[model samples]
Target chain A: MENLLGIAIGAILINNIVLTKFLGLCPFFGVSTRLKNATTMGLAVTFVMTASSILTWLVYEYLLVPLHIQYMRIVVFILVIASFVQLTEMFIKASSPTLHRSLGIYLPLITTNCAILGVTLMNTVVEGYSLIAATVNGVATGVGFILALVLMAGLRERLELADPPQAFQGLPLAFISAALLALAFQGFSGMIL
Target chain B: MKFQEFTKGIIKNNAVFALALGLCPTLAITTSVENALGMSLAFAFVLISSNLIISALKRFIPQEVRIPCFIVIIASLVTAIDLFIHGYSPTLYEHLGIFLPLIVVNCIILGRAEAFASKHSVSDTFLDAAGVSVGFALAIISVSAIRELLGSGTIVIFGHEVVPAFTSSPAVVMLLPPGAFLTIGILLALLKRAKVI
Candidate 1:
């Protein structure tokens, strides 16, 4: 239990997907302009990451390991993520048209989000976590991603009012803000657990 | 006409600076010039091969499953390069870590396939790939050069000290995550100021 808590805290605070690992940066900068969109995108990515992590864990443990074709994980894992995103898109379209409409292109874009694939692949291949651990880690990573996105969105929202130079108006300033946030997160790296 | 397609990717539609498509590898593995060079080679290999194959097969591929098809091809190419690096250069393989496989999701490759290669001729696609790859290489190499030189007080390329230590103690923070962002941030601002981007 203590180990699980450590993993959760470590993933959320220390090894944040966006602020630290630099994964899923497309949406990090693109959709994070608005708080609502950032939250929605965050939740959507969390769902995909968690779902794909569980499914990939099963595939890696049962099928790939048994077949000795573990090297094919890159191809297999991406296909799984793409299909999963497609399925989720269709389900949302049928059940909650409003949610689907709100998501817009970002829903489909989730298929290409490296953070989803990163978490899935990291859980199975790099860390070799157990099923429970992988699921927990996936959720924690998503939470970390959400935390970073929401914070960035809030910052960017206010940045709209601030006047700066022409060159650093948009993305350049956003990146500098992210740099500060990343520096602050660096302090968390020393925390024990 | 041919040269136009090639040159555009290098400057007009640079995968890193102008497009910002593949930041994962750009920021993750650029701690040193050696890693940057190794990554650029592997990225170029995958990008060029995948673009050529996808462009050649664009018409035959069904419209409904085009994304998945493109992904499979890219993934296979990434795996091939990944394995080749592991076998031939163990040190680079270790340095790249997961960012290598993560290249499968690098938007640049898939973005090129979908945006340009899927519609263009094979020759055109080849030039586009080469141009984009070179552009990406230049961007990452420059970023890595700045980071490695200032952060570590030296620049080491493939085991040789290209730039000797400038200071006894460097600003080690420049080698961390913030430094990557800071470098790119300032670089982007400078490019914007000069209208280079």
Candidate 2:
């Protein structure tokens, strides 16, 4: 239990998917234009990350290890992620049309988001966590992705009004803001140990 | 073969600075110039090889299944490089870590395969891939130079000290995640101000 909590906290704050680890940055800047969009993207990512981590973990332990084709993991994990993303998109479309409309656009994007794939590889290949531990880390990393997105979204909403230089208007400024946010997140490293 | 096909990716369609296509590795593996070069080599191999194969086989791959087809091609290439790096330079492989395998999902590679290589001829696709790979290399290396110099007050490229210790106490944050963000952010702004990007 203590180990699980440590994994959760470490993934969420210490090694945050976006702020520190630098995973899922495309969506961090892309979908962070609004709070609502950010929340929807975050939730969508959480669903996929948690599901795919478990799926990939099971595959790695049972399939890859048994076959002794550990090097095939890179190819296998990505294929699994891409297909799972497609599956989630179809499922959402069938289950709820409105939710699908909003979240569907982001689903395809998530396949390349890196956070989902990063967490899966971390679970099975890097960290070798158990199935439950993998699930916790996946969800916690998604929460971290969400936290960074929400924080950046709130900052961006206000940043548009406080105009800086012309060259620093768009993504350059966003990058700068992210640098500050990352610096703030650096504080969390001490909190853990 | 028009030279513009190659030049455009270097400037107009730069994967990192102008388009911001692959920020994950642009930030993650760029702590040292050596790692930046190693990543560029691996990235260039995958991008170049994948573009050639995808372009050559574009007609054979059905439109409905092109994306999956491209994923498989790219993933296999990445796996090959993963093994190559692991055997050739264990230190670089260690430093690169997950980012090495993570290249299979990099948006730039897949994005180019789907958008450019799928439509253009094989030769043109090769040039386009080369140009973009150079652009990515330039961006990542520049970020690494700034970080290594500022954070450590020294720059070493493959055991040769390019920039010696310039400061008694360097700002260590430049080696951290914030440093990657700040370096690229300011570099982009400066390029914009200079009308470069």
Where does candidate 2 stray beyond 4 Å?
A: none
Could you give the DockQ of candidate 1?
0.87
Q: After superposition, how far is residue A192 of candidate 2 from its true place, in Å?
A: 3.3
Per-residue lDDT of model 2, residues A1-193, tens digit only: 4399889899989999998999999999999989899999999999999999999999999999999999999889888999999988888899999999898789999988888889999998888898999999989998988999999999999998997999998999999999999999998987753
* lDDT value, residue A17 of candidate 2: 92
Off by over 4 Å in 1: none
List, residue by residue over A1-193, the lDDT tens digit for candidate 1. Answer: 3388888999999999998898999999989999999999999999899999999999999999999999999999999899888989899899999988997578788888999999998998899999999999999999999999999999999999999999999999998999999999999988988
lDDT value, residue B112 of candidate 1: 93
Residue by residue across B133-179, what tens digits does model 1's lDDT show? 99999999999999999899999887788998779999899889999
DockQ of the candidate models in sequence: 0.87, 0.89
